[model samples]
Target: MVNECAPKPHVALLASPGMGHITPLYELAVRLVTQHNFQVTFLVITAGSTVAQDSYLTAYPIPDLHIVDLPPPDMSNELLNNMKTVARLCYIVEQSIRPLRSVLNGLKRPKVKALIIDMFCTGVFEACKDLSIPVYSFFTASAALLTFSLYLPTLDCKADGEYVDLPEPVKVPGCNPIQTQDLMYLVPKSMINEYQQWFMHVSRLPMVTGIFVNSWEDLESVSLKAVKHEPFFANIPTPRVYPIGPLTKQAEPVLTKYEKETIAWLDKQPKDSVLFVALGSGGTLTSEQLTELAWGLELSQQRFVLVVRKPSDCAISGFFSAGSDVDDPIAYLPDGFVERSKGVGLVVSGWAPQVGVLSHPSTGAFLSHCGWNSTVESVKYGVPIIAWPLFAEQGINAALLSNEVGVAMRMPMVGEGGEAVVVRRKKIESVVKAVMEGEEGKKLRRRAKELQASGRETLSRGGSSYETLARVAESWNIET
Candidate 1:
């Protein structure tokens, strides 16, 4: 048992802007405070924060966790808005280093023992170094993505041209080759160089003391093995990797009207009968694609609960402004689409209680953007997936889930002449059917349940993830 008398070792955790980054890091802070003996100061970047992120922080005020919102960066909103997502985020972190240093200096009582930063906030390494504090990275994505990031620096030195125009698929050791078009986020040609530079800088794996990946061993054994024990990595200066994850939220209290209505709808449906469709906080479909998706779901004739956002020209349009807008997302659908699908489907605008919906008995399959958080949550609930990835490492995640993990059916990228073009309604309808009622769906569901059981075992006492986190916590104690 942990000593109740000693002053807790203080750890400062820095989280980036989006919900995807904020949620996992916040969960980690909760675990550090509640499970292990630690006092955490949770720091978050203020620029580009969304309503969802704000509401999440306001709702859960933990006892031992202190949330510190750093002042916004020096860059103007107009200039920041003009840059691409990766560029904007990198700029935000780069400019906040001085303020971050100030925040570190001001903390009194038990001084911070270690600082854990988000993957995007690696630029703070110098600030922490100046303050004589050790830094670790809280990587919120998969171990597979980490593997690719670790190997990318070598590719940067060796490759002659931009990755978008490569003649063949990009190959990472011990994993399947990926097409160039599916390279994380698709940057416009004008901004490609900026995106590439940001990735190259962050991909330097040896910069941190260690990495805490949000994945467990059973779900990503091959990639995790390649990262830790592969002989090819021996020559590289890699840090210790810990797969202490499948980290998820505690059961949230049902308080909002939207939450109540969503759960009530799920309760009315028959067991294992409904499909839950939600893109991540930032995943958006184009206007044409949104209409097609609506038609497709209507054609599939499956019971579905879809969380819709207003369509935009860019696939990641909701990244900065997901929940802030007041417009009805249903306005973007095909004419009378809501009326036609009223009895068969329910469409929610903006956000829904994802965990509650996923855990509902009526939820049979998830139509997801394959964000890491959504992917792990589906595994936790034993819900099979129709993987329709949109942006930012989601394609890699979709492939991992479908080809390697056996928990999802891959939705083929279909358009008239190019992969970047829209996916027609027929293809969407077909994949939806395959995951909802077909033979392949059964296999996916069975595998999903098995993985769910495995994940439960890992998070339980004396399990793999449980033991891994305990060991890390013990090391922190020794350091303090």
Candidate 2:
């Protein structure tokens, strides 16, 4: 193994205050501080920041890991309801960058080498530019997704309305022709016109020295190659793009007492017999969708564990309920679904021990929303997946897992005008059954094992990801 600890470097990771963003950043922080002897300060804000605090509290502690909190914005409305509100929050954060910059400047540590910021937190890059602090953009999504985002300028020209003929499968510079479906979540057609301008502006930012993606080379070789050959990215001489994943593998399981019990239950089950189902922390299911999912799980006749936040109006009584706030749409899961499947299933409310459950020997398959983190974690464990992609890049991740990776089966997506659509129960059951028992399922399982083996090999001594991390660390130049 490379000696990441030999030359200790001080680093800071700035995350967009969300679970999806913070979790990977936390894992990276852990790896840098523990494995590479780098001192890291994790910058966070009030909203959605508690998740990171809780996670770090439960995990290994590093004396150098500092949490710098920015004051909350004075707003009553949810940012999800309005993009403008999100932009305003970003503006406020941008204003707060000076204090952060001052703190970084004051860090007495001589080896403070680099600043890693979330892709969305462009303010950090702008703030630290004059200091010569090499700002690396950490993309939490797939390499294919990044490539697709880069090509949005081209896709925009060809687009007519809601759909566009997928640009020909020409070889992209750093990637292969990622299937159109895999790129579907790149930018929603509704937001493309506006986002295209944003992408264009951000792509030219000077502080973005390198792009660090949380993916492995073997998994995204075509896309990685495309990124290398792209013209727009050619001039950023200091910021090289690197793929260092699957990051989930580096995370140690830090389950709570409740999570430990869940793992114990999973252990009692037959090897590869249990299916784990979870939507990410932020995803919400409509009442109708919830019922269908419940019915579908029942029909699959598989031993399963479903994690939900709340029960819907149609939900049957006597099931475990997390009692989330009524107004929170996610709190509306169907009741009694857990009781009906009692002996055959377990329904965990609130947060789940996702990594621990997935790594369990009894876990045969994952019924996931196809979030990139979940996708990589499932692949890491060699768990066959029933892909039920929801919003964002989830659908794209599902497509790659099912069609490209050959290790997962995709559930049919229903709905026409985006928001009005939902995946039905019948289709969910069908896909689950196919993934759990059919010949295709067997093939996917075999492929999953092969991928899992490859992941292990890549993380071993002299592996591509390992070498990439070492190279990036050595090449880093601290502006202090």
Candidate 3:
């Protein structure tokens, strides 16, 4: 009898440990199976659960995709609460590699082609290599950062010691200038080793079969150009880079009460009249900052819907904190702010349907934390941004959105600190007014509309991004 258990044309997708990391890879897996014809095995490393994990996959019921979840590793009672978050995250994710390898034990057929991994979980590259499965590093961050990363091996030679030692705002060959402030934002004093380790992992890309970037050409032309055409100093060529994205979440109709209420409020508002405020799902603020934000939104007099993750003393929540169960976020707002702004502003405590909100006709602008996912979502929906970057690569993303993309205006953090940059009521009011109704806002809206059109065209069949993604599957040399 013929071997009926033979593997199909399979592409394994690896997701790391956070909502930010997992969601994108999950969406990519779904897309590969739905949009492209590839058979996908989505290998998620689940170490317990996260706040966003509760209802993360409420959409996308694709039948063709097979999901294998590797259990979280058991650890000693020496909990990682005090460990530098960067290292802790990496350490936790690395535990899944052994199980992932075991899961790969049966995927040895000739057609079992490639593994597309979240860059953070690149530890599995070794496993893929050992299994002779070609790896493609899928990055969810912006193309600018990808370009910056591609130049890391070169930057190491130029820097006297650490990247921080290269002075403020180091300029890469073909990309934008990167400030030491932003560098410090990504790799603070405590996480230097993790920073170096990240670069070390990134340096492994050339050895991989390809790199998948989540940005389209029009969105990040220069950055994409630099990565593809502009070679690094030593003529060390990079692998095939695919700009197959704006791979943002497609709109799925939401049914929750909060979503319904928010949508109702938005529908009642005037067209292009509301400022949709959300600092990504993981972003939290101090009470004082929250108060200031309330005052700013109220004082600005712009109609708005702010998704409030309960204000926290923590500057920002861990890359993903399973989120707290806050029944009411209104109490944290300035006195009567909610009451006064009634019918004018909506405060969505806990999670709101973001893609739906941005696509609404009432959405005038988004006060975003400039997380790459959030940034892409805003851009993809044609909403201009009020860029308030909190942590990670958000600062640079904010800068890129404002300076390079011409689709947003940067909001300076309060008191020159990363924690609360004390956005006062006055500044908040002015900034809100400028972005919502002022001339700059109109110009930004136009540019954003242009970008939205470009994204749609590129993502459409036969478009550049679509063609690029097609090639990625074809490169595996296997039939769907």
Best by lDDT: 1
The reply for model 1, stretches above 4 Å from the true place, is 1-3, 184-190, 414-418
Q: Residue 415, candidate 3: how far off, in angstroms?
A: 6.6
TM of each candidate vs. truth: 0.95, 0.83, 0.92
User: Which whole-number lDDT from 0 to 100 does residue 254 have in model 3?
Assistant: 74
lDDT of 2 at 59: 68
Q: Compose the digit string of candidate 1's lDDT tens values, residues 62-174.
A: 88799888877677888987887777877776776658888988875487888888788877777888888888888898888888888877777777666656778888887
| lDDT tens readout by residue for model 2, 185-278 | 4444567544553565345444577777888866766667767876754643325678888787344465565566677788788988888988
The C-alpha RMSD in Å for every predicted model, in order, reads 2.0, 5.1, 3.2
Ordered by TM-score, highest first, the candidates read: 1, 3, 2
Candidate rank order under lDDT: 1, 3, 2
Error of 1 at 309 (Å): 1.0
